[model samples]
Structures are given as C-alpha cells and as structure tokens.
Target: MTTQQAETDDSDGAHEERPAAIETIRSRRSGHNFDAEAELDDETLEELIRDAALAPSSYNLQPWEFVSVQDDNALDEIVELAYGQEHIAEAGTAILVVGHSEPETADEVFQQWADAGRMDEAAAEETKATAVGMYDDDRMGRDYGIRNPSLAAQNLLLSAHARGLTATPMIGFDHDGLAEFLDLPEDKIPVMLVAVGPSGGEEPERLPRRDVDEILHRESY
Candidate 1:
C-alpha cells in the first residue's frame, strides 16, 4: 500500500497512531437517519461553513455561497424537490452549495486586494478585466461554476465530519426546482445538497475498493 493508503487503514489496531485528519476522513460515513432532537444552531453551522469557505478556488475567487435550510417550510419544499427524500428534512441542516458565474465575484475580489494593499488599483482593474473576460466565456464559466461549488461541498462535508457531525453530499435532486426554490439569481447555479446532523444509527457496511495497481497509471493511460 502507498503511504497514504497505509495510513488510512486502522484494521491493524493502530488507530491512535493515525493522524487526526486521516482518522476523521476514514471514519466519516454518509448518514441516512439523524437524531431529530439533536440540533445544530446557526452559529455552529456558520463556523463549519467558515472552514468550508477556505477551500481553494480558481484565482482564489471563492465563487461559492451556502444556504442553510433550517425552516420547516423551506425544508418541506426541498424535500419535494429532492423527490421526497425523508433525510432532507430530517437532518439538522441542509446546506445548498451555489456557484456564481458572474463578473461580480471578480469585482469584489479585486477590490479587496486593492484595499488590502496586495495590489494597486490599476493592477486590480487590469486583473479584473482579464478574469472577467475569461469567466464571460460560456464553457469556462460553466466549468468553474460547477467545479468551485463542488470543492466547497467536499470541504463542508469534511469540516462537518471533523466536528463530530455526520453529513451526506447528495446530487440526486431536481436542479431547476431547487434553483427556483432558492430564488437563485440568473448568474447563480445550484451544485450540491449537503445534509448534516448528529449521527443516527445504521452505518452501511464499508464497500471494497479497487486495488491501487488497477487505478494508478504509471505515466499515462
């Protein structure tokens, strides 16, 4: 096994020897049921999201936004959009990951750089222009819009896992219905739904993975 893969295995009874980060990741499982009485307040949810926002994005633009679904009415709507998945409303919170494909993010980022003395106003303006030009292109904008949000979603899942919370990243939902439910702007795109809460029972059996040799290519396929 590779060093990372070896570190991920705890079957040898060296659980305490593994790094905390790896242990958190290896132990995390997608929870199907949550303790309804267990609650995650807005402050705690925001704290988790703060760490998730630190996830890397192209140009450090941080193109994602999260909507914490806590209200019963909103949760019901999301459950409908998600094809009546009971877990949608059962989790303490369902964070919607949305990505922006507009020049507005570039404007905000460049302006911040200028304010922080990281770049001169002129340089910031030039950089914004270049970035806006690239993001204005249909394919590139769509690619970044989807990919950046996905990165944030993964970060959120890991962050929640680290915080002793169970989370599931779900993509099986009606995208257009969710967009309408969230009242997203034209430039915003819904990318993922993350259900998070305190652990409920019924952890599924861990599935076997392909051998490293089968997946790792020497140089190229």
Candidate 2:
C-alpha cells in the first residue's frame, strides 16, 4: 500500500488526512490471472475474512458465512463447481461467500443489544419482531441474503488489495453444485466466489468505466 495521503477539511475547521483505504479503493482491480504456486498463510487468510465480516448488515443481522478453500482437493472440487474456472485452481485461496436467507440469530443479537445497554428490552424485542416479519417473506429474505453478503464480498476484495494481493470476485458458477458440495442448509445461499493470490506477473490493462457525469443523476434519474 502507498504511504501517500490526501487531506480534507472537516466540519470543525480541522484538517483530517484521508486514509490509504482511498488508494486501495481506487487501485483495486479484478485479477484474472494469479500465480499458481503461491499460497496464503493461515493468518493472512483469517485477517481477510475478519475484514470482510466488518461489513454492515441490515438490523445487524450479520447473515453471512465464509468457506475458505485452500487444500488441493478442495480447490479441485471448487474448480469443477465453478465451471472449470482455472483461476480458482491457480489462486492461493478461494472464498465462498455464503448468505443466510433468515435472521436466525435475531434472538441472540437483540439480547446482546439489550444487555449492552444499546437498546431497551422492549425496543429490542419490537425491532426483532419487525425484522423477523420482513425477512419471513420469501422475496425480501432472498434479497437481503444476497445483498448483505455482496457488501462483504466487496470488502474482501478491498482488503486483499490493501494487503498487496490480487483478488477477483466471480459470479459464474453452478450454484446448486456449490451448495451441494458445501452441504449448505436450505436457508444458506452461495452469494459469490472470490479467488485471491499473488499476481501471475502479467497484469491486464485497466478497463474503462463510465464517467461521473454519465452515471450520476442530481436528485432523480
């Protein structure tokens, strides 16, 4: 990561320096090639997942799980489930971002909130009831399941970049096969597959993106 900093003024008329995370966000690229021989140590892998888990979730439901594939046999299976995506095998690690369709931990989370004094008992119970009712609906539950984990996936990519690793998020996969391979429960869904490792020494040119003017709308689109 670069040591360069950007400066900005805050509301209190004090200057605050922007974090290197901005550079990480700007420079992060989706890697298509990775060094096949490279490997990620357990500590680094754990840290990556820790950073990903910090992503925000609706009602703090935190409905995401990860499966890290590093063993040769597991990688081989993942490659097949990912439709022969060679990068999955080449990368040092592959992470399966799993999402839960229901807020199964609502009771525990709300109890903690009340215990920590963040919320009164009555408020916590009411909030939990509302969240449960909304998530009980099939469509809403599914959407939250996928959407919340996607946020974590993005965080994972950025964390990898900050650690000087190349990572790619791929959606092209056999979802049913993956679920079967992982033996996921009915409520758990495979949201995304990410491969992480050192670069293969050949970097692709950055692709163009739409300019701010083209993509941005004032108040209404």
Candidate 3:
C-alpha cells in the first residue's frame, strides 16, 4: 500500500488540504460511465485488494474473496447478468466480491495468528474453539457470511477512490446468475459487484446529502 503524503501548493490562493484518507472518502461518488479503453494494471489492482482486505471482521475470519473480470468476452456475459447495465460493459474491470460461511476458514485464521506470535498456542486454540462454536450455529454463520463481506466491499470502494480510480457499487444484478457466470463455489455468496475504471468524462452532478441535524440524536430517541 502507498502512503499518501501531504503536498503543499506554492500559489497564494492555495488552501490547507484534508488528510488524504478523509479527502478520498469525501471525494468518492457513484460513477456510472467509464472509459473502456483505459486499462488498470495488475499491480495497482493487487494493492487495492490488499488495502481492502484490511477491513475489520469478526474474529479476523476474513471470509471474502475478490474476483476481477477484465476480459471483453467475460464482461459481455456480466452485462447480461447485471440486467444489461451498460457500465458493466464499458468499465475496464468488474470486481465480484464474494464471501462464504464455512467454519473451516477459522482454523487457518487462528493458526496464522499463532504463527505470527500474536497469540500463543493456548490462546489460538481457545479462539478457534470460540469462533467455531459461534459459527457452528446456522443463523450466526449466515450473519457473519454476509455482514463481513459487506464491510470489506466498502473498504474496496474507498481504496479504489484513494488510488485515483472510479468505482460504483452495483446491487441490481441477478445474484444467482452472477454466481453461475463467475463459477463461484457453492459455499460462497455474492456480496456486491463493483465496476472500476477511468471516468468517461466529467463526473455527474453531485447529489444532495442529508444534514447531520436530520440524523443525529442527543443521548437517545
């Protein structure tokens, strides 16, 4: 991951900037059109993925997987699955964010912590036991499966924006169709579709936002 350094402009009219992290989050918009000819390199994509994977998860279970579809032929099929969303076809890459509910992954997660000296063998064993016990319940497992991936998807969007790439989260697709199209494993669930690329032109007009006064509540409702 690249560390974003603050840069100062020499012009007299320059203003102090927000931290890069804050600026990136504030600047993100739902981009609908993309320059199809512009291609994203694998290294940049990997960096974005790494950054996204750092999102918090329950017990560090990290159940999500990101699949990038960049081929024209593959994208054509995705367009169909996405109900013919033109952006899917025009965007340089379509990222499938997938997650699964398997408790087996917990073992690996705990083992990694043990190997890294973050936890001793006894602690790792205890954590594994607790994680497996909780996730063995069908309802709890299903909740973690969906909830953790959604958090990771947000991280991916923010990371893409921070990297100077435009991305849009799409939830309008046929989920089963996308699963089959992507040949996703039966254990996995499709969380969201993100289309990333350079903008086709100027971004669309900014939409309105609700003021904090509309959402904030003092103490309690």
Q: Where does candidate 1 stray beyond 4 Å?
A: 1-16, 114-123
Displacement of residue 25 (Cα, Å) in model 2 is 0.4
Ranking by lDDT: 2, 3, 1
Q: What lDDT tens digits, residue by residue, belong to model 3 across residues 21-87?
A: 7667766887886888898889988987898899999888888999999999999999888988989
Tens-place lDDT per residue, model 1, 74-120, is: 88888889888888778868989998887567877889989999999
lDDT of 2 by residue, 24-126 (tens): 7867899877888778889999999999999999988889999988888988989988889888889968899999998898999999889999999999999
What C-alpha lDDT does candidate 3 achieve relative to the native structure? 0.84
Candidate 3 lowest-lDDT run of ten: 1-10
> In lDDT terms, which candidate is top?
2
TM-score of each: 0.87, 0.91, 0.88
Q: Identify the runs in model 3 with alpha carbons over 4 angstroms from their true place.
A: 1-16
- In order, candidate lDDTs are 0.83, 0.88, 0.84
